[model samples]
Target: MCLAVPGKIISIHDDGSLMKMGQVRFGGIVKEVNLAYVPSVQVGEYVIVHVGFAISILNEEEAQKVFSYLQEIADEGGQ
Candidate 1:
């Protein structure tokens, strides 16, 4: 199954081709993600990313819930 990860957008900029791009932080990792799908998203907002693209915006509460679920999964695997 494909998994969409939740992350906070750190910064955004045009890629010179007018495409919106951003740096997103997931836990301790950060990655560049395409933000064309979320035209109204801003830095400090949480977004659900799938395959390098930010697919949707999420509130901080919702984002925290997802992080909890991910942590549960990771904890399960570590045991």
Candidate 2:
């Protein structure tokens, strides 16, 4: 199954191209993600990322809920 994860945007890079990119932190890992889909996204905002792309912007509360669900899945998998 394909999954999209919620992450916090830490920084953005404007390399003069139409494809906007940013550093997104998920749990403890940070990865570069394409922000083209969320053109209005800014630093400190949360985004839903899938395969190195930010597909949507969401509020912090919603982001936290997704994180909690992921943690539950992780905990269950370890048992």
Candidate 3:
């Protein structure tokens, strides 16, 4: 199985063009992700990321809820 987590889009390339990269915060850690699919994603938005790419966008609250639930599951050591 594969897991793609929700992360906050901290910043998109100021150029706002194709071949753009962005910063995404997940589990309180930030990482660079490719935004080639959604080249228009803006800062402060959230996206679901997998394998170094942002696949889709989601709201901040919803992303946080997912994160919280995942944290709970991790704390439980899996089911």
Candidate 4:
């Protein structure tokens, strides 16, 4: 089962090209994600990432809801 996680963009790297990259923070883990698909994304914005790519931008409220659901699943799996 594939999952797209919600995370906040911490930093971006664009070298005047179509290929843009950014560091996205998921909880305490940070990973580099491709930002070319989200041209209007800015720092501190929430994005849904899948397979190292930011597929879409989401509002903070939606992001938190998804996070909470994921946390619930994690907690259930631990028991």
Candidates in descending TM-score order: 4, 2, 1, 3
**Model 4, 1-79: lDDT tens per residue?**
4799999999999986978999999999999999999999999999999999999999767647865997899999999
Clashing residue pairs, candidate 3? none
- Candidate 2 per-residue C-alpha lDDT over 1-79 given as tens digits, one digit per residue, 9 for 90 to 100: 3699999999999776778899999999999999988988999999999988999998767647865997899999999
Candidate 4: clashing residue pairs, number: 0
Cα TM-score per model: 0.69, 0.71, 0.66, 0.72
Pick by TM-score: 3 or 4, better one: 4
lDDT of model 1, residue 14: 76
Model 2 is weakest, by summed lDDT over 10 consecutive residues, at 58-67
Steric clashes per prediction: 0, 0, 0, 0
- Please provide, for model 3 over 2-62, each residue's C-alpha lDDT reduced to its tens digit, 9 standing for 90 to 100: 6998899988875656668999999879999999887668888889999999999886576
Model 1, residue pairs in steric clash: none
Top lDDT hit: 4
Tens digit per residue, CA lDDT, model 1, 25-51: 999999999999998899999999999
